[model samples]
Target chain A: MRRLIVGLCWVVIPWYLLSLFVGSRVLPFPHAVAIRFAELAPSVLLRHAAASVLRVLAALLAASAVAVPLGLAMGRIPAFDRLLAPAAYLLYPVPKIALLPILLLVLGTGDVSRVGLLGLVLVFQLLLAVRDGARAVDAHYLLSLDSLGATRTDHLRYCVWPLVLPRLLTAMRIGGATALAVLFFAETFFTRYGLGYFIMDSWMKLAYLDMYAGIVAMSLVGFVMFVTIDRVEQHVGRWQG
Target chain B: MPGVTDRVIACRDCAAGYAGRDVFTGVTLGVAGAETIAIVGPSGCGKSTLLLTLAGLHRSSRGTVLVDGTPLESGDPRIGLVLQQYGLFPWFTVLRNATLGLAIRAKRSGRRFDAAGAADIARALLEQLGLGGKESDYPRRLSGGEQQRLALCRTLLLEPEVLLLDEPFSALDALTREELQDLLLTVLAERRVAAVLVTHSIDEAVYLGDRVGILAQNPGTAAGEPARLLLEANPAGRRGVGRTDPLHHQACAWMRRRFAEAVRA
Candidate 1:
């Protein structure tokens, strides 16, 4: 908590200094932005923030639900790895943003398209991370469990799952950051419900204060996601500490 | 040491190696219930490989291993192994690591796991092994000796008829090693479980083993020749034999001389 406060001070002081140096409507003071954020949050900012948070979370869950199992299979099953590894390797490097238009066309301009695009962006990272994690289980632990008369199911449950969870959580954390960035781009198109729409709409009206407020809200979403993941990681991988 | 029919675990003419290289060959041994046979050898003499084979975690290329007069099976619940590294899962709590064997047994046998029963059993063993009040602590937080105790506790949970240890206490400091050696003595005597202990420490082998075996390659043999076992009864082998006992010292000295000749002659 102290570190967070100190970090906020570091960022806020420089930001406030920059705003004063600019001294124009384009660069409002941090305090001025803070007041505008407080005023707009209760009415429109909260709703936009909620929509954006929901879309990002839904996308993250959808991607994880699909990718984690696939990645675990790839790591453990040689035949499955041979089948899917080439596809994952080939598709992982492609800029997922380029598919945004296609997704928007197929899924329409609803939240589904935006969520789908963000899910596509995050899945590859998580898939590769989890696969590597599963494949990297140490031989020592495997032998230990084997000598205990553990079945294949017991091996997966006791040995593989616990060892791989921390890696998955770490990948989720990194992926969440990307999800927020891609969420911003996704919200800007054919949608009036997200922070991306509100921020861009505010910018068009030259309401710099409101745009800053939307950006802050979006950052809060990311901050909360990260903190949640850290808490879960702590609970699962406390032994690592 | 005994007739093959009276042994709880017996290995005859067992030879094992990785592809393209032999590790150990022509090994024969038998352990009756509650007996311990300790092995000491030069590095790369395949003492660990021999123990792993006995544990059924490795396959011997020749001969047969019999447990209770039946052919040995991989992952047999009646045999437990304690490794030198104290193979407790870091991601699990001390209690969970101890209970893991029971859970594996339950799942392997198609029986529904009774969590409460397993916890009770695990807690008792942990408490007996001096790991009480540490059920929730992960293995990473425990000291080296504690981690080893947790490993021992886990293996003992299965109540196996035989135990195979590969340098189980070589990592601990002197005082803790002696402490654990005594603890192991008590447990082995109480449980009447047959055991094979592999260690570099000749004193440890003399103190704990009813017999000591040396695995060493022949001095004139080619580099490709695998190490072979030289098993003998220990002069000082008995329960609670003092480390400084004259017989213990004699036994350690005799074994040291034999082991040196076996490894370097």
Candidate 2:
């Protein structure tokens, strides 16, 4: 399949070079860099990969946890929207990367700071999307259900939820992608064991092939995550004509 | 059709509009078990507001609307209002949209919806509206005509005693408009429910309404503008009495005269 071809081109071939060429430095290609990769080993690579993924996932999950409820609250209550919306808009445009010094000062040089930075960036976009999407739901549909003697819970489940969910899923797709990209940069700047960190560390040691290998790994991870989310969207939206 | 004993709705002095401003005042109307009524008016004359008030979407500024002698309330299960916007939930499939009313009511009643029964009714109604085989599609994927049909089906599945239609077909092309108008006429005639429709087109007014009214705009003051019912005319009854046929010419003439009178008043 096309996916198989892509996997081979991106993951298998690059990883092969990483293992064979970068693993065993035989010439001007440098045994030092290969020795570095080998010393790290498969377990270290995996641990770093897992750590990086977990950090990104944690940031995304935390952002969504806060954003969904905040968005719904804003959409349902006009007073809350008026009170909260201006502050979010004002904060959203400030580049999240620029806040690293502040985050480091507050949280110390740890995963907490990295995750917090990425989450701060992601939540603003997610909140806006959720608030606007939920607000756009038709008043008539809600009123119709309400008039039908539907309880508040019934209205939320049957009418409001259905009306707003597709929009939320779409927002999640966009927010998740943005958060992943931000996570990469965050790792490059402030982590010891991620694809971002690996690339930066290898590049500093003049290991161009290993740096390329790290870049390839991070890209593959991002692509896989995006595709998985896209699949979820399709499955959930299947009933829609 | 149900017997005379099954008279389901009545509106007595059911004058309603917006708060602090009147649309139609001292307006009384009624629907027998299987009767249909339609209200027609010029642009911005408050016909839609009246329909909303009657359906319990808005509270009456002046009087009361009753269902089988019980006062109407917001979210009354026996009433449905279809605005020109179609208001189809963009996230829902055609089948889901159509069955939403039943689902909401059932959940409130401590019973879940009978999906098979709801699906059957929705399918039949969608078929009648020419939306067959498109049940799994979303509103965004549907044509304007198709979305309107889905809205109609959604309203019909609950078997509302009163249906309020606010220019439901005006958004479509001429051909589609006529086609939908005819479909609605056929459906309403068969269902025999009371309907109050606000329309701009005189041809549509004559074609769809059993009884039609031309409403006037209240002269604006330092306060907000109010709306007044200029005349409550029964086109069908007039035709039935051999006074005048509800033809295009007659309807147009009536509209022109009514418009001139409203302006003069």
Candidate 3:
């Protein structure tokens, strides 16, 4: 709690100074934004924030479901890695948000297109991280397991999966940030829902207070998610220390 | 004890090396039930390779490894190997590491595993090994001796007829090393399992081995030829011997002198 207050002081003071220096309505004082954020938070921003959070949650699940098994396969099996790595390398770095127009046209501005874009942002990060994790399992551990007459499935369950978990959680935290960036771009396109659309709409109308409220809501929601992932990591990866 | 009863694990004329080069050649040893044959040698003598062959972790390039008269295959359930570093899985708690061997066996055999029963068995084994009340702790939290004990527990849980250790105690301090050596003897006596231990310490070999094998280079052989391992009986009969036993000291001194001569030759 003390650390949080000290950290807030670092950011809040800098921003207050910046606002005072700018002397423009564009970047309002910290007090104005905070008051406005309090007013709009409960009724107006909550619904949009919920929509964005749900989309991100769905993307996280879908990306993990598709990537984890495939990443593990690539890591553990050389032949599988040889076959899949070429295609993954080609597609991983292409800007996913660039496909927003096509996605909106095909999926018709629904939640599906937005979620798909966010999924694209997160999947590669997770896949590469998990694959590297799997490949790096100590040969000694495998030898130990094999001495017990382990089947291949047992090797995966007893050795590879547990070793890969810490790396996977770290990748999730990194991927979460990229997914949010893509989420803003996706929601700006064809939706009335989501914090992204709310913030952009407020900015267009010169309602700076509403814009700041939407940004704060989105930051809080993302913080909640990142905190949740951190908590899970602490629970499962305690043995790392 | 090593040669009196029928051999539980036998390696005949075994030669092991990687990439078509022979590390050790013409190695032969037979371990009877409740007997421990310890191998001591200079580094790179292929002592570990010899142990690996017996455990079926490595193939004998020019010979055969037989477990109870059956040819050895990789991942043989009848053989359990403890590595040099005590290879306990850091990700697992103490209890989980102890029971993983049984769990792996059950999974492979397609039997219905009773997790509760396995846990009970592991709890008893950990308690016996002086790891009581530490079942929930990760391996990293344990001391080196404790980690070695955990590795021993993991291997022992599989209930193998034969145990192979590769320099299992070389990393410990002198006192911890001696204590673990005693604990190991008690475990082996209680279990009556055939064991082959590879070590650098002549004292450790003389203290634990029913017969101590000296492994060294074949100085007179040609460039392509590998090293040799030869076994000799130990009169100390390690069951009750300790640091104060004059007989153990004599055997260790004699073995050390012989070890120097063998490696030099």
Candidate 4:
């Protein structure tokens, strides 16, 4: 708690001092932004925040649901790994944002495409994380499970899934940030509501205070997502501690 | 004592390897029910490979491992293996690790496993093995010796007909090693389960084995090459026997000479 307060002071104080020196409409003082944020909080800010959060959550859920099983299969089965490894290697490094145009063409500029774009961006991060995590599991554990007559499903449930969970959560934390970035970009185009759209609209209308407020809201969402993931990791990775 | 009988485990000219590269071949050995056979050899001598083959974790490239006069299938649960690293699942709690095999068995047989009953059995075994009150703790929380014992507990809970242990105590300090050895002896004596123990320690080999086998330098390379039986001495009566025992000392001396000879050859 003390660390958070100290960190906030460091950032806020520097920005406040900088704003005082700039004395420009583009860079509003912190108090002016705070007042603007309060003015917009009840209706305009809440709706946009809700829209952005919904998209991010939906993308994360969809990505995890697809990536985890596919990753585990790729990791555990040598033949499957051989088949998919080259494809994963080729596709993982390609910037997913670059596919925005292709996705936009196929799915049109609807919520589906936006969500699909975000999900597509996050899936590779999660898949690679889970695959590497499963591969990194001690061979001894697998042998032990095998010696115990663990069937394939038994091995997956008891051994593979639990072992890869922490890595998957870590991947989620990383992918969450990427998802948010992609979400902002996706929302900016053909989106009626979102923090991204709000911020861009505020900027165009010379509402710099409101724009800062939108940025603050987006940062809070990212912060909350990170903290939530950290907390879940702590709970599941209790043995590690 | 219930399953203790003349259910022999025999490796008949067994050959095993990885990726078509032979590690060992023609490894023939036999253990009568309730007998403990300890194998001693240098590193890369296929001692562990032989154990894995016998346990059915590794498929034999030649011959067969027979349990009770039938060829053993891969991953036969009746033959419990304790690997050198203990092989405790890090994700599972102590109690859960102990009951893993039984739970799987239940699931396989289409029987609803009595979790409460299994927990009671696991708890009793843990308490007996000096792991009382650590049922909720994961394997990472336990010391090396504790983890080894928990692994043993997991195997024992399943009542395996034969036990294949690969250097089960090499990582422990001398004192802890001896303590675990004694505990192992007690368990074997009580259960009378047939066992094959592979170790680099000559003294441990002599102390644990009814008969000690020494693998050749590059065992199982040729068609006829296999682990040759080095000594046949009953150490069963020597339970709790210290290193000072004349027979124990004699066995150790004989094994060391034979081991040096095998390595040289």
lDDT by residue (tens digit), candidate 4, B40-63: 887777889889988988888888
lDDT of each: 0.88, 0.72, 0.87, 0.84
Clash pairs, model 3 backbone: none
Full ranking by TM-score? 1, 3, 4, 2
- Report the lDDT tens digits of candidate 1 across residue range B5-79: 459999888899999577998888989999999898888889999998998889989988899989889999889
Pairs clashing within candidate 4: B25-B220
- Candidates 1 and 4: which is better by DockQ? 1
Q: Output DockQ, candidate 3.
A: 0.78
The lDDT, on a scale of 0 to 1, for candidate 2 is 0.72
What residue runs in model 4 are displaced by over 4 Å at the alpha carbon? A1-4, B1-6, B19-21, B217-231, B235-240, B261-264
Residue lDDT tens for model 2, A97-156: 889889989998899999998889788988888888778867776765555556766656
Alpha-carbon runs more than 4 Å astray in model 3: A1-4, A105-108, B1-5, B235-240
Per-model TM-score versus the true fold: 0.94, 0.77, 0.93, 0.91
DockQ of each: 0.80, 0.44, 0.78, 0.70
True contacts kept of 3: 0.87
Docking quality band of candidate 2, CAPRI definitions? acceptable
Candidate 4's error at B82, in angstroms? 0.9
The best candidate by DockQ is 1
lDDT of 2 by residue, B120-203 (tens): 988888887888899988788889999998888888887888887878998999988877887887787789787777787766
lDDT of 3 at B19: 95
